[model samples]
Target: MQSSSKLFPVTLISAELRGDLSEDVYRLKPGNSPDASVELALTRLGRADRETTRGVPVVLIPGSFSNRRFWYSPKSIGLGPYLARAGYDVWIAEMRGHGLSPRNQRYKHNKVSDYVRYDLPAIADFIHEQNPQPVHWMGHSLGGIILAGALGGHYLQQTRVASVVLFGSQVSRIYWPLKVPPVEWGSRLLLKSFSVISGPRLKRGPEDEPIGLALESLRWHGLLGRFGDADKDWWAGLIDVQVPVMAVAAEGDHQDPAWACRKLMEQFGSPLREFLCLGKKQGFSSDFGHVEMLVSKQAQLEVWPLVEQWVRKSPEVAAQLAMQPDRDEASAVSADQA
Candidate 1:
């Protein structure tokens, strides 16, 4: 285990009210690891009236090659502000070297293991410090993978987390060729030669991802691989996780298909868990894509409300939804509407 003193003080960079929501951004620096000067940006959104923030704190983490903008854009149309306006205290965290968080000393050397072991705990501690209640966590794509890794590795305590929501996230986006020894070795070597996978250049998103992450992914999908890092077997540990979970996948999402997401959800040990697949066939207005599952206008109307239900409604609702076995957005819509 690492020293707790690796965490340094957090600095509040700016605070101002944005329309109905109050926005505050803070910066955190860890004293050690691959990068000492790596600063993480945590943006908090709540009602302008503090007294109205009665709901449990919720943390929204964006996926790879993304920032807080993925959760709440400049127009204030994203889910962060939506949750905040609904009376829940909302916090959106940027991974190191992304968004407002500047690149660290060893930014190119960063991996998901580093994020789970270091960054998440720091964010959790800071959030729990201010809001003592057990917080709800919602993550999209790679963000969800990182959250699950933290939970499975026991980096985050189950008692501190009220619930978890993973959107279009899975570790089983399998490429069988990567399982071959020659392919695995070649891929790893090629990835290590690059500093990052450039998001802007690739037109994938607005942020770049470290090559370290690519290398790590290669190892996980390789022939000798299981869904774990060098030091921790996160996938194996997920079977013991008991926190309430809601895993949501979209039918149109080829990046992380619904079946893989469902498999991940089924691996969890939680009794209160629900799996949601969003598509026209499932009664959603459209088959939501990876980004569209959380960001689009349709999601605002049909999806966000269900998330609110998952957050604010009784645990029994999730458990009952789980019991159906045939549950989808259609059942979720009726349940939330009911």
Candidate 2:
């Protein structure tokens, strides 16, 4: 991947706290303040005069070992730009240690828990404060897991999230045992070790090779496997989550199989849930794997439409559709009786 010589401004704030994978830090000086408050920056990529039609504020959270740039990449396969074009106030977050949001001076390492406790909550609070409207949340891979964990708990409960969209994420490690590991042996040991050693080495930017290499490491460790029994049961409790959820998986993705993806939606037990599995013929490469589903070029044309439509539809509209009696049920009954 070619390096970008262009310099982008980034702010460094003081460390509020520290966690296993990252440190809780405020966005102080956006351009260069050692002691500023949370800062916001905007990048205009497309036609400026196109009347911006704002919909629900949408926050795009990237997967593990990645930064917000994954979503904003010029060649991103996901719906970041498409959603922006569709008129959603889209914001991409860089969890501590990634992208522009590195830890403050005192903090050294980044942690997965930091994402749940600090990164997401901060984003949710910021969006709510700025828009005063319900925000929509979308995450892929580890990002999805972090959001799910946060939503399941008390975090972000006060915020009015319109919906939650998880791509290739399950509630517990059980769904992806290889990714975590047995509790007896200390779950997340592999991940934690890797993060401690390699997390700081990762650089920010739109380079595909580095991103691919990072994902490859996770895949090899079985980080994408299905959750275990304990995790499955823990996730089952999250079925009571009131928010609408859309779970998507790729048919050819070894990281997240169709069954596991379906299981995630089923666990939600939300009548307002939807699941999709992208087929290889749908333009998804056979090796599309796990992370590529979000960054792959084909996702925009094939996978993004489902998400776009869901985001646009109102809760009332979705409820009405759900209330409609299943037409296929009658056909199934008739066939069974026959």
Candidate 3:
């Protein structure tokens, strides 16, 4: 099952036709983190017609307490499929023990540091090997934060990332109580007592999160705490991140407010970065919440097109957009051309 392609070993778990699009799921067992023994599941969506030219590759990472279904459902109805239908080769990554990726030995001990240090880089390498073009990365919530961690820690080279679009992703949200040592330390102690945070039980999402993630967050939001590990200050390191970035926030999102999301976007040193807030004032039909920002029906009409626009924001795609303001380049643009 080991792929003959260069780099680390990759196991193609399944490859079959799902409706009109072909679905190929690969499991990557990273050799570096032998202690964790985590196997990441990556689901790729592409055109059913193999002869058709493929477009740029886009990787979608879901947030905490979620799975690959966040981007793609069992019915093959989600943004992932939509993007594939539009000629883009789309990949949905399930981190650690989430979704199709089974629980590992250190499931409960998984943290963003692990993802940034090992998983993200592995995914990047595999995708680049599959398609020599630079990949576009899009993350939601914790997924976006993890991408930032990878970039800030210098784990993921900016040159490999074509552009980044983050939906409801930010790390600068302030917890007033977390500023207190007693509260931060006490909270960490309480969280450490549990193995995982139940998403459905807490009405957070569909997947459970490891307690280690909460502990890591506490340290980041703790008194005078920064967004890096023992070796580097990721928060400050973002100042050197030159990747093209965009952060999307929703006004109705009480969990991660717009201001805080904007604050996180401001951390990036990319000159080609933008902050978008979804609300009535911004001409959006409705004020999107954290989850609704990307999932709901409103997003289908208003945001999905915008996402497609951003995905095709490269030199060729931009030229196409400029020429045909009314026509969509999604179906017209070919992989070799765009």
Worst 10 residues of 2 by lDDT: 329-338
Candidate 2: regions farther than 4 A off: 1-47, 50-53, 74-78, 105-109, 171-237, 280-288, 318-338
- For every model shown, the clashing-pair count is 0, 18, 1
Give per-residue CA lDDT, model 2, range 1-338, as digits (tens): 22111222233343321111111223422322232332332222222333343456788787765666667653433467677666677667765545665444423333344445555665665556556678778888767876776765546673387778888875432434544545323533433444243444444223112222232334334544322221232254465676777777766666567667666666654456666666665444453457666666666565677688878874665466457666343221111000
TM-score (C-alpha, index-matched) for candidate 1 = 0.91
- Cα lDDT of model 1 by residue, 161-276, tens digit: 88899999999878989978998998888777889999999999999999989988888898878777777899989988878888999999999998899888777877666788
Candidate 3 structure quality by residue, lDDT tens digits, 1-338: 55734677678989999989999999887777755478889999998985266678999999989999888888988889889989998999999899988898888888899888989998988888888687889999999998888888999987778878888887777889999999997898888889999999999888999998889889889888888888888888988887777788898998888878777777887655667788988888888898888888898788888788877774344344446656642433222101
Candidate 1: residue pairs that collide: none
**Of 2 and 3, the candidate ranking higher by TM-score:** 3
Comparing candidate 1 with candidate 3, which one achieves the higher lDDT?
Answer: 1
Residue 135 lDDT in candidate 3? 85
Q: After superposition, how far is residue 216 of candidate 1 from its true place, in Å?
A: 0.5
**TM-scores for all candidates?**
0.91, 0.65, 0.91
